[model samples]
Target: MGWIAVLVMVSVAIALIAFRVLRRKGRDDGDHGASSVDFSANLALAVYLLVLAYAAVLCRDGLSVSEADVQAEAESLTEMYWSVAPIPEAMPVRSQIRQYTAQSIDLDWPLMAGREMSPIPGQTLADMRATVLGLRPVGEESKNLQQDTLDRISEVSHARIVRSDDASTGLESTFVILMIISGLLVIALPWTLGVRPTRSSIIADLVRVGVVVIGVCFIILISHPFSGLGAVEPDAFKAAQRQYDQIDGRFPAQP
Candidate 1:
């Protein structure tokens, strides 16, 4: 599931808990000192807010790093495709590389971004290897083309492997858990300190709810750094595909 949904759910759960706590306190006949309760509640809210802010910052940084890594891998693949395109005999292999690279960006990328593993791993790898093998005959005629193709193939292979590994790391789970914990803490802070039922207290509750709602919206808005969840961003994937296309275009012109 997306982080937005998780955030909303957590917010709702916290709100419900807060409501129950308020109901219980309203019914209590004991003379609890309002001043002491207010002081404690405010203090707890401050601490919770501080911790939530820190966690959000940390998660944001982690997501940014992950995105950068994915982009780098895409660029690397593009460069690899272009590097060996100057060889005439490797044209067919170059075409295959282009096709695979396009598939990676157009198809595999969305799946990876959504935290799904590739369904046809064996076939994908086989296709990549086939492209590498196709360059073998041409490599015999030109040592430079052969060496270049070999190097490009290695780069593409390594990038693909790293991408696959990154997709499986389950970063989304960490995000979901953090959001849930933050929501719970937000709600529990007010309850544990026994917030009064004054007009000011009601305003504070409204403000807290508003904060949670805003946080949920922010998470949803930023979920799409390039392309949201399922949709493909052609421009985002362009760097990788361009390299593949350049190889395809150049192979025929060489030798």
Candidate 2:
């Protein structure tokens, strides 16, 4: 943040100094093809703004999808945990569910920020599925419950994969580099019109640069799913853990 502030100040100082030097030398006589300069500046500004807008949309969509995936996984785990109660051999399965949720909240959440997935949760979930399949359902209702439990497990798997994928999702590096270059160019365009270094002109230039800095910075901050000020939280996983606590405490006899 300090460096960013310094950079902004330095860029503004340079632009102001250049404007003053050009004006003193009578180089900004407004006679060097004003129309052509206006056309090029306008075109650059248009393209820069369009790219920024597109990047903003992508960030928004990624955030929304990631949030939804978290909720979906949590809900599916809750359902699967509940669905196991009807089977006689489901106590171990219930324990597995609890372990998976605990590991996800305690281990997976932090690892996800670095795009690293903890294998324990996946392995526990797979074991839970195998254990569920091994349960011998003697009645139709028990069979149906088993099927539902399997379906919920499937949902949990899908949601978990999606959450992992989104953990590292963001604007591509190429696009980010392009955005930075274009943002700088956008701020530089005003000076190209040979505008005089009057107080009003300098203030306008400063304001334009400040606005671009804020916008570009904002987009970059939110682009990553697990980093920066706008990064997504593990609220859904936390809620799942809380639910597990409630359920696990209720069944003190089961371990």
Candidate 3:
């Protein structure tokens, strides 16, 4: 994603020089054509920036929600692990919890790039619920603990749904198209004005092109929260691994 800006700038520079070489006789550098083009071009630039800003805000909010979802799920997993610890029949459930976390961090997280997720963690969670359901509690306290465990499982499931939504979220293609068209218009309008393209004017146009490239690339990078630069990582799950270690007092990574 970072390379996108660099590539755009290089390509624009080459194209600009080529167009300059093929230039014909220019019209008089009069005030009328320059002012009209300049005004329209400025408006184009402003519209382009506003669209990028809106897209950026959308992506940023998605990223924040994704991070929060991950944190919530990890915390739920940790709580569920502790909830199942006291039930003798639920020992296997602890292992299942660990497996789900492992699959989520290692398998599901990567698949989020394609707006997909692995079924392994989901299946593991279902199995854990079944295991807890089959448990027989003795006292009211044990029943309460069992209910707490089930509630944590539900919380984790809800968090997963939110995370999945975030993974699929991104800027709309229409916005991308609009941004590209407007940005190109900004770069090309001055040329269409027939004002003489002097060395200084050409240099200024190149700088404008650079700004457009940067804006376009920045928006593309921020289009999604699950991939590319500044993506929402599985750091929360990594922390959950440590939490599990503390909960189990040294449980291994795998079942």
Q: Ten-residue segment with the worst summed lDDT in candidate 3?
A: 246-255
Task: State each model's CA lDDT, in order.
Answer: 0.58, 0.77, 0.82
lDDT for each residue of candidate 1 in 1-255, tens digit (9 for 90 to 100): 355676667666766677666766754334466566556656655665665576556546645655766676666556655655665555665566566656766677667665564555436656756666555444454666566656766665676676666565532545545554565556555555454355666676667777766764555444433334322244535766655655565555565
**Model 2 agreement with the true structure over 148-186: per-residue lDDT tens digits:** 999999999888889889886777767666766776776
Best-fitting candidate, scored by lDDT: 3
Off by over 4 Å in 3: 1-14, 25-28, 250-255
Candidate 2, clashing residue pairs? none
For candidate 3, write residues 152-188 as lDDT tens digits.
9999998998888888878788988888888887887
Q: lDDT value for candidate 3? A: 0.82
All candidates in order of TM-score, best leading:
3, 2, 1
Candidate 1, residue 134: lDDT? 56
RMSD of 1: 4.6
Runs in model 2 lying further than 4 Å from the true structure? 1-31, 134-140, 193-196, 245-255
- Model 3 residue 241 lDDT? 81
Against the hidden reference, what TM-scores do the models get? Answer: 0.70, 0.80, 0.88
- Say which prediction, candidate 2 or candidate 3, comes out ahead on lDDT: 3
Judge candidate 3 at residue 235 and give its lDDT: 88
Candidate 1: what lDDT? 0.58
